[model samples]
Target: MAASGAAVLHRAVRANLTARALALVVVVLVLVISYATSLRIYFAQAHEIATTKAEIAQSQASIADLQSQITRWNDPAYVSAQARERLGWLVPGETGYTVVGADGKPLGGGLTLDSTPTDDPGQPQAMWWDRMWGSVKAADKPAVKKADPGKRAPVTPDSKPR
Candidate 1:
């Protein structure tokens, strides 16, 4: 009876040990899965921070470029040069001459207005006011209405009244 009692006590201790080890293993697995999710979130936030920093740097660079342009535009010499190149502006005492090629196109790099005479001698040229008056006359005319070809006429059922 003493030997049987000792064997029964040993079996109970072994069963308790097995259950405790399984519970410890399950707890460790849960902790590992939670830590993995946290690490993924941390890395994703780090990537987003890097991307936002790059965008901020780009915006700063663009702002610096625009500030430099503003500084250059504040100079009178730059403004005068731009006007001369873009609008064909000339100084009060300066006479500007455009060199024309045989094809009737301006040869040099400076901007030139369309001052060339018409090639047809028989056709009378209309002045700026004449063209403006013609446009005004056209605007005064009533608009002509036309039926849409794709539009379908309404249909009445044969069983109903005509």
Candidate 2:
């Protein structure tokens, strides 16, 4: 009976050892899975932070450029320069001269008023009202003659009639 009791005790110890080993393996696996999930989330958040920082830097650079432009526009000298260069403006006591080529095009993109057609060196320039009156008078004149339908040019395939 003493020998039998020893065998039973030995079997009980072996069963307890197997159960503890199995429980330890399951707990280890759960810990490893949780750690892997946490690492993935951490890396994703880190990447987002880096992207946001880059966008913030770009926005700051754009704001700086706009602020510099605003500062330049605030100056009166800058405004006057822009007007003279872009709009061909002339200030008081400044003589405005335009050079024309043989083709009659202005050399420096200078402003020309088409109203004064008969520009004479001896005569004074026409007033705005006089020019307007001249244009009105010209428009009041009727056409000398109308073209016959038979004389009209043949239409091309690419040309659409009005």
Give the count of colliding residue pairs in each prediction.
0, 0
lDDT of 2 by residue, 1-162 (tens): 999999999999999999999999999999999999999999999999999999999999999999999999999999998888877898999997878789988886545667755778788988899999999999999769887999988899988888
Q: What shift in Å separates residue 147 of candidate 2 from its native position after superposition?
A: 47
Cand. 1 TM to true fold: 0.59
Which sections of candidate 2 miss by over 4 Å?
1-22, 98-162
CA lDDT, every prediction? 0.90, 0.90
* Cα RMSD, each candidate: 6.6, 14.6
- Residue pairs whose backbone atoms clash in candidate 2: none
lDDT of 1 at 157: 69
- List candidate 1 segments past 4 Å from native: 1-17, 108-162
Candidate 2: 10-residue stretch with minimal lDDT? 108-117
| Leading candidate by TM-score | 1
Clashing pairs in 1: none
What is the per-residue lDDT of model 1 for residues 19-84, given as tens digits with 9 covering 90 to 100? 999999999999999999999999999999999999999999999999999999999999999999
